[model samples]
Target: MALQFDATEYAARLDRLTARMRDDKLDALLLFAQESMYWLTGYDTFGYCFFQTLVVKVDGSMTLLTRSADLRQARHTSTIDDIVIWVDRVNADPTMDLKNMLSEMDLLGCRIGVEYDTHGMTGRVARLLDNQLTSFCQIIDASYLVGELRLVKSPAEIAHAERAAALADDALDAALPLIHAGGNEAAILAAMQGAVFAGGGDYPANEFIIGSGPDALLCRYKAGRRTLDAADQLTLEWAGVSAHYHAAMMRTVVIGEPSARHRELYAACFEAIKAIETVLRPGYTFGDVFETHARIMDERGLTRHRLNACGYSLGARFSPSWMEQQMFHTGNPQPILPDMTLFVHMIIMDSERNTAMTLGHTYLTTAEAPRALSRHPLDLIVK
Candidate 1:
């Protein structure tokens, strides 16, 4: 079995979840997030795109309701012994199987928690689930329950994160040489991803953001690639993933002599990120971190180019995004806790000036100061 953690760690995590469940007065949790399942039981599979769920009873029993494809998957990758597979047929609604399973488990009238906010639970699946079990049980949105528990990394998880961070550094090493003038986006992307694979790392939760020329202003990955100009800027946001745990890094590399505006924006980003780090300790909140970035960017008159949110929590995540529920955004009262892996970015894109500058990296939060996961310096990459 490819269990990410040992038996004791899994047991401790189960205990923590059950304890949290008791505190929240929840009888069971319908964990729809694949990350939640992986964290709790080392259940790894991309089959979460289908109608699958892990039902966790507060009594410490866990049963995974998935398709036949993941039946052996659960057995091999997870500690979950009780695996039930729902038959697939035309117009099949797996929620019926879930409802029947819940009924058998005597969860029919209990206060059940459903992870409604995750991509694993689609609106169609959620609606079917609600119609099938809402009247049968007291269902509530407990999407963040497991997420909150997974926020603080355990010693074992941090080890994986550190390994992932090393792989990210390796990727950067592979990309730096190829990021100069006339560089091929395809080559750079492949080199970066290849470095991770060679280092025994897993595929990242999302596509690496790669754009050059005017596209360097983009923070998101899009179709089509272009060669780097003689004097161009390239932005990259990629992660090193190990056992699905991510340690992401972002940067904007200058192909030639950086323009005056590029230098200006880079200076602003550097200062903003450094200042934000000062408040990354446990005494502050996630909002405090973003406010720190906002204050610096606004004071420098770069507010329009700056992102509304500086960064977000990172963990073992599934497709569509690597960002966790907790984010560094204004009005978010989530406290900055130690052992949390966070990815804070400083993005400044001035389309008017046709320039871009981005600086970001993941950090493991500590009581005093957050420790940077990446060993790479935060200096502007001028090739």
Candidate 2:
């Protein structure tokens, strides 16, 4: 049989989301974000303007409202049978259709849980609704409630992640050969992207971070006119998403020969990552991982200058709070559980050598242990 997404799995996820809303005494959940839309329904469309609105009823039934132009795709992609299309004329509010649809569906007066952050439900939208729907209904923030459900992974989710990680291995296999002296970063990225496309990846969660030598220290540098030098360390932190499942991989490379100090530094970071992974399993807090890394690095006299979080959950799709919230790094005590997928990244910048090194890989948590998906050897390659 041809591979297909499980509608039942999507239904189960909706049930979980609804149960959370019910436990909180919320009548319905208003899912209006890309990740939630894709999570609730399988509908994936590329447009930042046409907000995909979903009012998940307490009974587990949902009504998805979107632009009329996208109606067909929504119906085709979503598991939900009920869909609403809104197409209003000039000089008229577009959300009028939404109001009418909710009213017709008897959802106007319900105690709704709003995904305010994702929907961009501005104060104006709330005020308009306050004057309109608030006569019968109440709206409260439901993002956190819904987010709690997606924080873990399921078996099917792990399979998708495995596929994505395998694709990353393939992309690296294709791009590794391009890391020669004077090799342009842009060309290497193109080669890696081509490999991802060839391996059936739609696109990467983010652009491939292909940095060489000094540029690698910046972590998020753009592909510029710089070319790889024989003495420089070529670092890559890239991944591709398959069926909305994402996997990340980070590797460091050296063209020709690397100095003994460079090799020793890379080995320290490598050992640090391995030491963390050695004891990684269920029931450990994020704080434990942080402390473990600190202890390991202290032993080696290495500094963690990349502002990297120990790790975070990964699966299904890239959520709002990704891999420990890079911009605002906060530690979570949520114990790692079985079936949860995560990425533990060790990006170390050696100030003395003016070079940075990265060792990142995705893992699937099991009852017994964590499993690595990428088969690429962890040793530093001297191309």
Candidate 3:
């Protein structure tokens, strides 16, 4: 079995999920989030780009409805015994197959929860499910049900994250030396990802964001790569993944001697991260952390250059994004809890000066304080 955790751990996760289902008055939960399925039953697969769903009942029974490509995948990677394969054909609808499966489970006329916010559940597919099941069952949008449960990491999950963090640090170490004048962004990115894979780590959920010079001021990954200039700034953000768990890291490296402005911006961003770290303890709201970041950046007069949100939750995730549901932003009421993994990034993008400074690392929130996952120093990296 390719299951990462023991049977007992998976069972406990399912139990916790079913308990939440009962509390939400959900007779059955139709989960479309790959993260939810993987967290609950160790059902890891990249087959979620197509239509698929994991149905979990209040009685603790779970089943997966997926395409034929993932039939063996489900068997080898998950604890799910009853796996139904939805065939592919011209103009075939998988949602009808899902409706039939729900009916077979005696879910007709029952209150069902559906994960509407996930990538797996498209609007067209969702409408089809609603049309097919509306007469028999009440479909409730419980997008955050499993996600909320997964916010806090278990001991076993934390262990995987710690290993991933170490791998990320190693990746940075391998890539930093390559950030020289006339260096290739592609080569640096390749070295970074290669380090993670060679260390037995999995591919990250999203593409690594790598840029140099003017592109450094941008955050999102774009098409085409550039060669590093003699005196340019470069920014890299990538996560190390293990068992689908991710620990992300971000750093800005200067190819030549950094200017005074560069040092000042890096110092401000680093201080902002440090300020937030001090308050990342149990009983603090996520907003409190963002507020601290805001105060520090505002005090440094870099408010215009900083991002509105400083950080977000991190966990086992699939493609499109590595970020988890909860985020650290203004007015967020989500409380910081023990065992929650957070990726806090102090990003200061000054388009006016054509410079970018980002310092980010993953941390595990403990009862007392948040513990750093990446062992690398937070200071500005000038190559």
Candidate 4:
């Protein structure tokens, strides 16, 4: 198998996961998240977008229930041995198939843990699943079981994160020359993504965010393209991906002469991110990080301009997002831990002044302080 990690690594991960399942009194786990499956058994497939699940029992035995389309996909990319295929046909209800499979494994009355909170578990599929299995077994919401275990990176995972960081820096370098006036957003975006591919990196789990002028204030990626003006702002949020692991970065570069408001917002972002760094270590909570950013931004009188969350955990993820369950948001109690990869961002968007300023980078948390993955400094870019 072309597993990203060695046999020993995969074995250790499986051991840790099942140990947690047993602690939670779970007889088996219905893993709907592709990240969860991939993390546990190297089951790589986009087929999770459909109805598919990896059934992991407390005994550490595994089975993948997917469509025939992903039969070869599972065999080729995963360590999973017991693969069961559900036929795909019109008016077919795969939930019935799942019910029968659960009975065969003697899990009908067992306490089964299901990952209900993920992109892999759509509302339709979840509803059908509950209808079919709720009365048959004891169902528990164990959405964060595998995600919690995956938070602290091993040495091998950290190495992939470091390589991804290098790719992000290369991407930034490639886009710098094309960020000036008259530059095309398409060309700039192409150059940035091209750099990652050339550096042997995979496409990010999410689209690279690119916007200029008034659109710079937007955080989410939207369709539409335009040219950079002589005096405008361009916001770029992108991630470097290696073997599905991510190290994300964000920045808003000045095009020409900066406005007083632009400088003020940048100053606020700089102060907020720097303040966050002090609390990004083991002693702080995810909530503490957000509080730190919130206080700094509010103290600067930029409260309305700042986002609710400062940043989130980064790791091996599939399409739609690279963010993990842990996040730097208000009231979040997840403690900062060593060997965790986190992204710290301070985005100040001022609609009144039509200004935007963002500064962020990925870091690997340690005992003393967090180490920045990117070699680039958080300097205010202007071209």
Give one digit per residue, the lDDT tens place, for model 2 in 123-161: 565555446556657777776666567667777777788
The per-model lDDT (C-alpha) reads 0.93, 0.70, 0.92, 0.93
Q: What would the per-residue lDDT of candidate 1 be over residues 280-322, giving only the tens digit for each residue?
A: 9888999999999999999999988898899999989989899
- Kindly indicate the candidate among 1 and 2 with the higher TM-score: 1
Which of candidates 2 and 3 is the stronger one according to TM-score? Answer: 3
Q: Tens-digit lDDT track for model 3 on 1-383?
A: 88899999998998999889889999999999999999998888889989999999999998899999999999999999999999999999888898888989999899999999998788898888888888979989999999999999999999999999999999998998888998999999999999999999998999999989999988889988899888999989999999889999999898899988899998898778878878999878999999999999998888899999988999999988999988999999998999999999989999998988999999999999789999998988989
- How large an RMSD does model 1 have? 0.8
Candidates ranked, most accurate by TM-score first: 4, 1, 3, 2
Residue 170 lDDT in model 4?
97
Worst 10 residues of 1 by lDDT: 175-184
TM-score of each: 0.99, 0.87, 0.98, 0.99
Clashes of each: 0, 0, 0, 0
TM-score of 3: 0.98
In the range 1-383, model 4's lDDT, one tens digit per residue, is 77899889999999998889889999999999999999988888889988999999999899889999999989988999999999999988888998999899989799999999999999999899999988999999999989999999999999999999999999999999999899999999999999999999998999999999999999999999999999999999999999999999999999999888888888888888888889999989999999999998889888888999989999999989988888899999999999999999989998988899999999999997899999999889988
Could you tell me the lDDT of residue 238 within candidate 3? 94
RMSD of 4: 0.7
